[model samples]
Target: MLFEDKYEIIRKIGSGSTSDVFLVRDRKLKKRWAAKIIGIYSGGGTDCRVKQDAAREIQILTQLDTPGAVKIIDVFEDSRRICILTDYIHGISLLAYIHKYGPVFEQTAAKWLLQLCGTLDYLHNMMPPVIFCDLKPENIMLKDDGKLTLIDFGAAYQQHSDVSPGIWKGTIGYAAPELCHGTAVPDIRADIYGLGVLGYFLISGLEPKQVEKLKDYSGHRIVSRKLDRILSGCLSENPGKRYKNCEHMAVRLRQFLRKADF
Candidate 1:
């Protein structure tokens, strides 16, 4: 508070490999915020990797500036640390909801998937195009009003070329086949693949490993040949086989819906 911003800590909410997230309250404006603090050094030497990650995340979030994504409130960076303050999501993460309520109904999953499509579309359409390398269920927060917000941009990268070996990586089951190999620069299709995994999880409570073993959706409440076909396209090992863009996926998903509303 002496040299940095004016936010009082409420509690420590979450943490990641590079940062510690805290629930904080803005002193002047009296608003709630989530502050992610990353130490600039380890063992008395500057941790350039950590610092770059923290700085890049801040840059990405600032550029995003959209309603579907979490909004940034303030930031404080110094020789010792970098603190990023963002609007507190104040909602249950999709992963937590799934653990508590089990799988959702078919239409419910479709609705959320549609929302996700729009969000990803926004990201992929950015100037350099932002690719969310870590887009598992935990990073998606579900608000009380049924809206979904994408959170955590630590593993996100600008999509101009394939990622260099040590730049960024992703979750195993949720990440695409090419992404895990550390060569191919991931594209929007990678997020599409993740979206497919999420939709499967929401409708059938299946993980990626389980999805690979599945052929039919008979046992699950969400039974449809069209859905099976669509998900299969999304999970394709070859990115070229996936939907050209999120809009196409959203259109196909809407067609599979039993009701006209979407």
Candidate 2:
């Protein structure tokens, strides 16, 4: 389907279970944007839960106004689908970058992790606290300016002490063990666990089977013991053993960067 008269669809960029993303250009503004079309209905009838999820995503996107996050441009809804337009990041996914360039340098990885930590801290400190359950490499885009932007808020949830535990919605390898067990309530620590996995991936170009089983980086001459300790702390199986919050983890990462002269 076509968007407004001003926007022209260029090509399909990505697709998921609920949405299809297209690279669209605005003739009037001469700018490119990512248009996500979310199907809200099935053959039988409208899917109320999907509709609510789309609305919730829009609400969360509107509240976010940070360089670390993708900015929402416009949102449109028709009888069949909901369309969300956002900035088209002019770069490749972190996953692609890693595949092309091999594992990132320690300094570069530290810089990116610091940025991610700050971004997570911002989300965790929001009014109701936003938990970004999905933080895998695919969801991270690296721009030409050397900045990283987090995308896809479909699995994000507002932290509410009153709310009961819900179904876990996150990437398998990157997801926290607590999420898989369904025994503990998810919170900011879940995101911390994701960050730890991301760090391990960036440094070693290998995905750990589980956060708790993260390989000892000391054996790798390139990995610093201090950095490994930080990653291990974040990857703790028990949430209580991890950093109290994203801010705390960010602080620790910054300290490591400074010590390493990054």
Tens digit of per-residue lDDT, candidate 2, span 42-150: 9899988788878878888999988999989999888899999999998989988888888887778878989998898898999988888888998999999989999
Residues 59-166 of candidate 1: C-alpha lDDT, one tens digit per residue: 899997777899887788887789888879868998999999998876788889999899999999999999887878888999988899988888888887435754
* Off by more than 4 A, model 1: 1-5, 213-223, 258-262
* Alpha carbon lDDT of each predicted model: 0.82, 0.84
Candidate 2 colliding pairs:
none
Tell me, what's the RMSD of every candidate?
Answer: 2.4, 2.5
Cα-based RMSD of candidate 1: 2.4
Candidate 2 lDDT: 0.84
